[model samples]
Target chain A: MNIQALKTYLNCDNGFLLSLVQKFVEELNDTTNKITLAWQNQNLTSIKLNAHKLLSSVKVMQLKELTLSLEKIEAGAASKHISSELEEDIKQLDIQVKKVINDLQLTIEELEANSPCI
Target chain B: MVFKCAIIDDDPFFTELINHYISQVDSIECCGIYHNPFDALNKVNFQEIDFLFLDIEMPEMNGLEFLKSLTTLPPTVFVSGKTTYGVDAFENNAIDYLYKPVSFARFSKCVNKIKAHFEHTRTNSQVKQQNIFIKHNGIHIRLAVDDIFVIRAHDNDVTLNTNVRSYKTHLRLKDIYDMLPLNDFMQVHRSFIVQLAKIDKVDGEIIEINGRTIPVSRTYLGELYERLKIK
Candidate 1:
């Protein structure tokens, strides 16, 4: 997970980036779980809203593919169509988001380890 | 001059990123940050801040609906992950629409626009804050803009209700309204124009100011609510 882009976009030092990414890592599970639950409940509005919330952080994390996938989910949910394709997309999104979370966790570890050095 | 701003986004990551960007700009400051629109709606004093950073989608109240429900709002910029709300944002008179994961470069541009807008409004308010001379009881009285709280029209004459006393002048209600600062006053009824800041409470169609009740007509009621900060 390359954080150089996130750092450049934030235009802040390592300390601020670590704090923000840590916060994102902390809240990521609950946010993705909300999306999953909303999908299971077939609550399209909740799905769209939660997906949009996740997108906000994913974009800042500089995950282009995840951002695009989330956008598709948000739009699909808004359309109120619970189709096989949308379900597949959501399933794939869950996998990708989990991987992203793992990567963010590693990034957090690296930042924390390097904090004293900086 | 440093301007105060508030951020209302459910996404803490986005809020933190935006807050960081705001801290970089010396001319702008973040006064508040709320994850829930409902909390912001109940707590935010629109008069205290120069502008707002609003998120369009929240679990409680969407940003567009939140902005609509408010009787008064500072200039707002909608920060959302979706690209679809651009037109809606502008329709609601949003200063700008920022797509989520906003870059520092884009945020800086938005800051410039807000600063320019406030500068224009400040210039207009300075020009609007002059005293008006009116004849009351055969005497030409000079009244400051802040002195009058209400203006009511009866026949061909209008009464200027101030804090201390009331003065009557032979002027049209529209004329009296035109003379007052537009931001501080609103025409709640055809025969009544009340200073928005001086409003004590509103019960349905009636607005109370200084222990006096003024009727708000249907024509201007919606707009009157839109202009005053309803708690």
Candidate 2:
């Protein structure tokens, strides 16, 4: 899992993503694990709906890479034709997103640490 | 928002035509098409559909009566070869009525009418925002409500100029007016709707927008002043 890429994906400015993590973080060691669980459990219906809502909001915010990746996963799942190899690739992509989120949070903490709000 | 269109007509050729027309326009997606109205209604019950391309004189359930049966109805555009139903169709407050073998040109006009209605409703809903979904060759493009810098009404169609690209939608000035947000847009001339915020300055007859001159018609100059609230 490319944790760095995952950090970048989740580090975006959408509150929904933050809320998404907060909603499901307890279920996995990483974002990929959680998303994979959703897929393996045959929750594509929920995933497809969430992916679409997120796509529109994310497009408005200009998160092109993240939006595209989410679209690919959703479209494949909805079509019910994605290979196991593609699923593995999506899992890797999930780790990349997790890294993005981690980096963004760390950067925010560092900026706040260097400055005194008091 | 993408419009999921359900088409009900016995003719497969016309159904195919409707599908072809829908495929050309990105705004309306063809969700389900049925020769039997009852079958179509069953599908509608299960799926979330936004628009219906209905034929009035069907075998089982008539289009008009079916509309009455809907718990919640989206806008509909009627397609029929006979002209007798045109007035009744319009009276039903359907978005637009079309005669069978719907031409691309007429189809475009119908789409414009629907877009205009949605635009107005959306503006009223948001109070100060207007957004348009543009479908050019089956691709839906969402433009920001305020991104339209100016709109130029040409020979038959209107060209929307924004900060990014020039979008050509088949529409007339009168039709476009209803869709534009009242707060941000004002018809200053016969062929122009200037974004009030985009107007750099207003002279006696002309206003400069994006370094281009837009005329203020004698008929609409007063309207512009009212819109501008110029003291």
Candidate 3:
């Protein structure tokens, strides 16, 4: 996604869009854990499919850094390259997700502190 | 006492509103607020709850189907956005119906009905030994052991004096006397059957309850003295 559009979506106006991002971040953390396990188990199809899905969604979420890294992982899985560099890039993406996730978590906590509901 | 209540609907906003309402209500405590009926169904199947606050339309499983699947039905008060399901909810044995954007007043009304039913059930369960079915006009109502103080036969109908109201029903005094449990209810005369528990004071030709007097007949005098342990 372009930087301007990313800024607009993250503006989140009334906090609704922000909550959806929080939910997405929550799902991404879970899917990343699953993707790594599938890769280690040499389930190439499962690994490729999971990385592809994450690649598309993280771009929508404006986590361009993670999105680009996941696309490489998807390509490496499809070609059965299983190279150490591709593995290191995917590992770095996991750390980046954790950091972005912490940022979203803080945003959610601040919003909830202001207005609590279901 | 808190009753476990489920809030089922597909709107997160409404679910949040319901959660807010439940937190404020004294009698009802929230079990969970679900945005889908399937999630609510999973909870109901696993939990022992006293009541359900179900919404009609859901994605996979609707409220009506969920209510049908319950093996043990707690009293359900349906919450919907419309009134067309009144007959449907009632036919499924719902205790009450609530429309969407539920106002506190309407919610209060539904809870009041559930409160009354629960209170009546608690008292009835304790006094199962003796019951008197009183016919008021065309309606037949069950009066429990603690309800009846005295039964007075007036001309062609039997007058049942209860703590709440007096009902006159067209049945033979003999038939009414026979209907009561033999041990607790004694036919003291042709016109009266006095509850052995409720007779606070007894005197010549008069049987009383809480300062009110009911007449006694000569034919049943022996039975009254026998019950009162009079010499």
Off by over 4 Å in 3: A1-118, B45-47, B128-231
Q: Evaluate model 2 with DockQ and give the value.
A: 0.01
Q: Sorted on TM-score, highest at the top, how do the candidates line up? A: 1, 3, 2
- Cα lDDT tens digits for candidate 2, B86-191: 8777776578887754555667788888778766666675544457776545577777768888888888777888988888877666555556676677767657
Docking class of 2: incorrect
Pitting candidate 2 against candidate 3, the one with the higher DockQ is: 3
Q: Give model 1's TM-score for chain A to 2 decimal places.
A: 0.90
Worst window of 10 by summed lDDT in candidate 3 chain B:
B121-130
Quick one: best TM-score, which candidate? 1
Docking class for model 1 is medium
Q: Which pairs of residues clash in candidate 1, taking residues 3 or more apart in a chain or in different chains?
A: B71-B226
Best model number under DockQ? 1
lDDT of 1: 0.82
Q: Rate the local accuracy (lDDT) of all candidates.
A: 0.82, 0.64, 0.68
